[model samples]
Target: MKLTSKGRYAVMALVDLARFDNINPVSLRDISLRQGISLDYLEQIFSKLKKNEIVKSIRGTQGGYVLNKNPNDIKLTNIFNAVDEKVKTVQCRKESKKGCNGKATKCITHNLWDELETHINTFFENKSLKDLLNNNKETRV
Candidate 1:
């Protein structure tokens, strides 16, 4: 189960925003340059973010984006959900009767993969932008 660039880039961009947005709103162009992500892509990601109310857009010469809530209050899971990102380890849906191998029963590893997905999602649920920023500061020091 690999995460797509959409999920990873959204996290990276938000981390960058959390780092500098306290000074002023952060522009996607600036985040794009620093994160080496395309501006167009950031715009797309931010559109979803804005719609989800995770961020608010500003207007004018210094117009940009800012977090709608505190960094500590914004969990990674929230960002992933806002961007329609899913952490799926199994090919089949959990509620579906079908198996991952398209057989009568689930594959031997299906339970293992499902458990792993739960762990991964729980980790993200427990992590917030503040945790990431604090971890960065600790590593730098």
Candidate 2:
């Protein structure tokens, strides 16, 4: 399954926050410039993050946003769900119990994709922002 820009950008933005968390309440504009993300887009993404309590906002001249939880406690799945990013591996209409074939019966290949999707979700559920940071450091080394 492909991760949408909202999901990817949110994760990147949060990582940027975690990276500079020592400063506390890093502004979206700063994250946007550093990560090459659009400030407007980051604002929209952060709105949802705030709603989910993944990030907290502070007001004032030095106000911005900060992580609500520690980086190690913030799972990748949390980021994905906060932005409503669906990890869809199939073309099936999820509202219906029937498979992508639009019939009452399940498609022949439905189980394969379904299992793969489960594994994909589990992978994200197990991964945290700290994991991403550690991986990045390894690659840089």
Using all chains and alpha carbons, the TM-scores for the candidates as numbered come to 0.88, 0.90
- Give the range of the ten consecutive residues with the poorest summed lDDT in model 1: 93-102
Report the Cα lDDT for candidate 2. Answer: 0.89
CA RMSD, predictions in order: 1.8, 1.8
Model 2 quality (TM-score): 0.90
How big is the RMSD of model 2? Answer: 1.8
Flag regions of model 1 displaced more than 4 Å.
none
Q: What do the candidate models score in CA lDDT, each in turn?
A: 0.91, 0.89
Clashing pairs in 2: none
**Positional deviation of residue 21's Cα in model 1 after best superposition, in angstroms:** 1.5
Residues 18-124, candidate 2, lDDT per residue (tens digit)?
88877777998899999999999999999999999999999898899988998889998899999999778778857787766777777788889889889999999
Q: Write down the TM-score for model 1.
A: 0.88
lDDT at 106, model 1: 81
